[model samples]
Target chain A: MTEKPMNAVSNEAVDSCGCGCGREDLPWSGRGTDLPITGCRFSLYPMTDDFVSIILGALDKTDTSHVWCQSDALSTVYRGKREYVVDAVAALFANAWREGVHMALEGQISRGCPGDVSGDSVLSCEGEAPNASIVAAATQPALAKLSLYPLGVENYIDDIAKVWYRAEELGLNPTSIHYATRVEGSIRDIFAYFNDVCALMERTVSHYVLHFTINVNSPTDEEE
Target chain B: MTEKPMNAVSNEAVDSCGCGCGREDLPWSGRGTDLPITGCRFSLYPMTDDFVSIILGALDKTDTSHVWCQSDALSTVYRGKREYVVDAVAALFANAWREGVHMALEGQISRGCPGDVSGDSVLSCEGEAPNASIVAAATQPALAKLSLYPLGVENYIDDIAKVWYRAEELGLNPTSIHYATRVEGSIRDIFAYFNDVCALMERTVSHYVLHFTINVNSPTDEEE
Candidate 1:
């Protein structure tokens, strides 16, 4: 397998293990709210065009799901053919304070992960890492937890979209949107990725849960 | 009319003249984007049960939007006619921002030019002013160069709503959502208000022109 370098882009050796070889939630430190790392510093994964498109598609569809707390878009990953790696921003803060999540990062996406994509998820756009180096570390999960939210996890996509758009309108860049759909090539690739993830969720997770509200936020949408 | 009080309920009614009473455009202030002499400094309106109902009403019709931009609560106004508001912290913020009309103390409605309530064109709520005060302010071409959007001016409502929900989900108070909505509402309202004044536009604004765009970097909202 490639080692956080250009040669690692081949995907010839991805999914080796699950102990976060590349799924470093540690970078999520100081990102999510209310976490033990609330103020502690840590670099988060960079948001890419693929990151947002997948989230948007999953948000619209009825089957796929991921944790969604918007501190910032760190990175995105479609895993297990059904789940996606979603680390909501400042989740710890929101949960603890009963308020909105607030992480201090902008243009978080369109940035890229700290190292390389490391072949964690199936997004073909992985492999490109952000030029910035990591100085902080992810507070242990004991300090804060990031998990995919089940379907119907408090419908807030519309609200989130507004934040995304309004920020852009005000010249905030919000890179998440501009890069996702506006960037031409990435849009098509990401859309296809979400389609596959949603399909898998419908066929698998929905069946497993049976009547347990899989992708409950959006049932009719085929690509949410 | 109650004379401007030197010490007021949060500095909302300081300038007896610019009060959105007999005039428009924050009559108290002589400039655009300027809060009146005695304006709401609390950045919020006091919460009462009636105010709570408004919140429920707003949330009820949130789904009609195609994009999260500022549009009327057409769906919510009618659909949630009977819905009760959530008196929770966020709801308080939403109601204030929606009803406050950008200028907290200097509200257009309070000024007496009840622009256009013919349909579900705007968010009209109960104000503390007496009928006599507001009615007295109503006159020919009553109100200032305020803008109200087209009744169906909803190209951006969906987008605004998403940011709103995200703000809520992110744990920001409904004010963020309300402020966003009001900005949209004000943009639409100002457009409408101005249209009423000028009665014509040289060109069509847009199929997707946001009735309004708000400042996310508001001094307080940055509290994260």
Candidate 2:
């Protein structure tokens, strides 16, 4: 069967550099769909408990291919009010049998595998087991519904509220600025004002459609 | 007086690419300065009637500097959205004069000077006419406080609102998504949901500080 083309706009897991640099995927930094690894175009390190100390050092470099990993190795990416345990250390390679995009996810898998997940010994294995319910055994296609990391609505709404609250805690206000700002108006009142506007937009637009079209020209650096 | 070190961020117009890549003052595009223009970037086209056929089309590859500009040539660019003309285009060249950053600008000047502007025929003969408005004339040192383009609030706010409206239009609900999605709970909803979150972030963040920073290091794209 012929592989489908990736569209730049529609691609979620696919990576493409907008720089127009012509260099598709480089392993280091944000050049394309690369994790910030110091060496190598890409590396797939085996995650384990005391067996390794990789996650501690390059915590920021890990991507989302790791949902079955658990360790202090997980770096929390704060979306807004919600924080997800994003394991950068074990990114890309989701076990040898895995095919397709897998992020190094860091979360605790509950005892007793509920889904198709079967392993030598998940509890004792170095890598934290993900929700068997999410990944399903690698047999049929991996469940597309699972988050690279566990998340919910809180990641969106609650976290935004959290950041604002944090800003309030930081005491950075409209007048707190040092320069003559475009925000000459009241930013102290902006949070509430913006919240209202968002509410209105949400209410109005929620009735519309997102118009998702599949694009075949999108490129992912990791693919080639 | 001694000139400052070349390393310092200067106010003068410096076209790093050297071809009509727009001005240097507003040099950076994406990534809060994290992303600069990659290769030979393109400048936005000029928007006035005089610009449409007269100046822009007649521009030559060697015409980097406008020292020899005719009165009619300067009229269109110096015309409207006065501050944008100066702030985004003119000032970049001004600094470039001091620092020697050369580049080609895509657009052109024209005879379409606003009526309010002085259209002295004698001044035109001298190549020293008020083709553009001197309305936004100001000096350096007031750079941060300058109102050359005081539309920051409107731009950022509008951006956030626009994206939010787009997502809400998606009308995601419980039936569409797969996981614990607040609405449709489908896998695709995650991306839409995040974009919505980003829209909100862009909205709220615009109000905080013009010097805001964002470091988004996500773990994975999505393992499908």
Candidate 3:
């Protein structure tokens, strides 16, 4: 049999182990389940006089059926499949967007955590993402700074550079910041870029993250 | 003179070039001034119905004499000396802290950006950090996730691991998350750790960043 990299095993390939001894179920293997456990923790800031209402109303409108959500004082965390997690964030942001009030959201989204198995139970839940309909909805201009980390990977900088190059290819014109890449585009294109980066890295890196700081309806843009 | 790695030049060493040809003042060098050119962009969230007053009060209390401040729709950006940038964040958080209120702050702090030279005008402004007195004040329990990026470095992950290991030595008990390291400790200790990590990486990397998401007085902790 050809050798594969330690973290390159596809979800289907990891479903069963050789000899069918149920060794994959053992704790020592560190392979909790076949599902791609994904989750995100995010905080939203709505720049309005009625900030509390805007934030609360958006969270209330978000549909978290396929995901498990925990709302702490610091931030809200959604854990489940990748599509659902991303959908929940989009729904929350879209719901919170006001015409005159600018909004910003900071979030860290990750999949395949070696120590986090909490999402394994709900990984098999079936259905399209709840907010898939909103993908085509008209979105305001969005500016974001995204930094991805391929944990435990030796050539991590190369992976980052690849993502940067890919973003540029999509006409995003990524600007290199201190530790992040800044991109300005429509919300639809931005989210698509986020998904594309994840797809590129998941093939080789078991655990990866997309830490995003997004701003919509900025007053500075209007002034310029 | 021996060969030196790029970005390793000390602040004092970069003051003048050999033979004093006045080449350093030109725009081609991409070096605007002698200052280190530090800055931070941050958003604060207080989990309370009176969040507006609390946030406004904190900003009013913070002494920004040594830094330039810009409040945008999404977040506030502070530019100046490294110590003042850090101190502004600490001062803002401390001033905003209210009893029975859980507060969270998200910020990106960076020094030595090649493209940014706005802080050059105030580069020589000198004073001890304005928030130095608050450093020793009793602070609430703070939980934070910090990710440092050393841009353009080949062995970036190795540098990240070094910071992670050093955090362990300080008894911060860092938990490896997707793109960040989570640490729970006193606010003072946590900020100190942030400084230590920056110092460790700044020696070799020119444009390094500390993206911090900090939460204080969480209700979830009391539940436990």
Rank by lDDT (best first): 3, 2, 1
Tell me the TM-score of model 2. 0.18
lDDT of 3 by residue, B1-224 (tens): 12111112111211211111112232222122234766777777664545557767888888878887765334566777677777777888888887756567898777654445453224566768888788658367788877565543334444555676777877787654433456777777777777777676567566555778887755443222
Q: Which lDDT values do the candidates have, in the order given?
A: 0.19, 0.20, 0.60
Off by over 4 Å in 3: A1-35, A48-53, A112-121, A152-173, A221-223, B1-39, B45-82, B95-103, B109-127, B134-143, B147-190, B196-209, B216-222
Write down the worst ten-residue block by lDDT for model 1 chain A.
A208-217
What's the best-to-worst order under DockQ? 3, 2, 1
Candidate scoring better on DockQ of 1 and 2: 2
lDDT of 2 by residue, B1-224 (tens): 12111112122322221110111222212211111111111121111212222223333211223222221111112222222222223333222221111111222211211111232111212232221222123121110000000111222334433333443466532110100012222222322343244334333332111110011111222223
Calculate the i-RMS of every candidate, to one decimal place. 24.9, 23.2, 17.6
lDDT of 1 by residue, A1-224 (tens): 11121111121322211111112122311111111110011112111212222233333331212322221111112222122221222221112111111111111111111112233333332321211111012211111110111121122233323323432443322221100111111112222222232333343221100000000010011111
Q: Give each model a TM-score.
A: 0.20, 0.18, 0.64
- In order, the B-chain TM-scores come to 0.18, 0.18, 0.78
